[model samples]
Target: MNAPTHSHPRVLVTWESKHGSTAEISYAIAGVLREHGVRVTLSRADEADIDDADDGFVIGSAVYAGHWMKHAKHFVQEYSKKLLAKPVWLFSSGPVGNPPKPDEPAVDVAEMIECTAAVEHHIFGGNLTPSR
Candidate 1:
């Protein structure tokens, strides 16, 4: 008997951005995944389709006042059962300034990880523009 061979892994990269910075990061991450031959679907957390047949997930959100945007949080909460079956990675974009103010993970990250059974979490620097 022959073993099964899988096609390129499909990954969903979703995010919620208050001022667009986090969305940009999500796009960049998807681009890299595609470059490595992964099938990537990039969508906003609110608009993303959780039912897609993805092998893994990369979820991100912009942190404001130490909390993730509601849509991202809701996404995790709403689809946690599905998410728990696969590998999930979480990211937060916030803490601006030289050396990054606060220099800590988003306040809700721990809970999000627990809910999704995420394998890892990353914190990225955010860009703050006064105009937005």
Candidate 2:
């Protein structure tokens, strides 16, 4: 549904990035949403100020050892109430190199999905160094 010009629907894009890649992805998502005329706000998960006024949310995190970063987990826990009441989407970035199909949600985000009743959960392939 589209909102009137006076009140454009706002979507918050927040994420916990370990090496800036996740942040870049978050920004790209925000840009696309903006191009579609949706008001978007990009913020770090730990620094995000999620509120009831937000129409939707796109939360992301960098997965480490099959788990989302700590700040991302805390962010979800801290704002579970507000997030659950609105349209929310969850995403995680990990599993470098050739992307493999994951049968299930990441360890940390699984609980968040249940808690927020998220509309969808997406897992993105991450960038890793050769040494890593």
Candidate 3:
């Protein structure tokens, strides 16, 4: 018998954050992968000119007033072709500060996830207050 596994080569955790929290989240995730002896690369979404990384973590922090920071959205849109050809995951940081009102629209991260063929997707609660 053989252990089931993926063919992914490396893991990349890329994020675009405001007030630094999302970066911290990605860093923590990267740290865990490193501890497991997995090769990992991390960069700001704005700097991720990645065609593909055997496996990828496409993290994006939510910007309520608008949406994901432009750079993060661009990273995905710009690399949609490459991402769809490989495994990718997206994450966001937000829901802080002014809580989204009942009328506030819900952010839909699914469309992007499906387009990327990402093995999985996740959303972690983040500080919404600007004071931090």
TM-score of each: 0.91, 0.87, 0.76
Q: Per-residue lDDT of 4-111 in model 1, one digit per residue for the tens?
A: 656899999999998999999999999999999999988899998875578999999999889999999999999999999999999999978777864698889988
Candidate 2: the clashing residue pairs are none
The TM-score of predicted model 2 comes to 0.87
* Candidate order, lDDT descending: 1, 2, 3
lDDT of each: 0.91, 0.84, 0.68
Candidate 1: list runs displaced more than 4 Å.
Answer: 1-6
How does model 1 fare in lDDT? 0.91
What is candidate 2's lDDT per residue for 66-122, written digit by digit as tens?
888998889888888888889999888875645454444577777989777899988
Best-matching candidate per lDDT: 1
Writing each residue's lDDT as its tens digit, candidate 3 over 92-127 gives 666554452323322556556755776766666656
**TM-score, predicted candidate 1 vs. hidden true structure:** 0.91
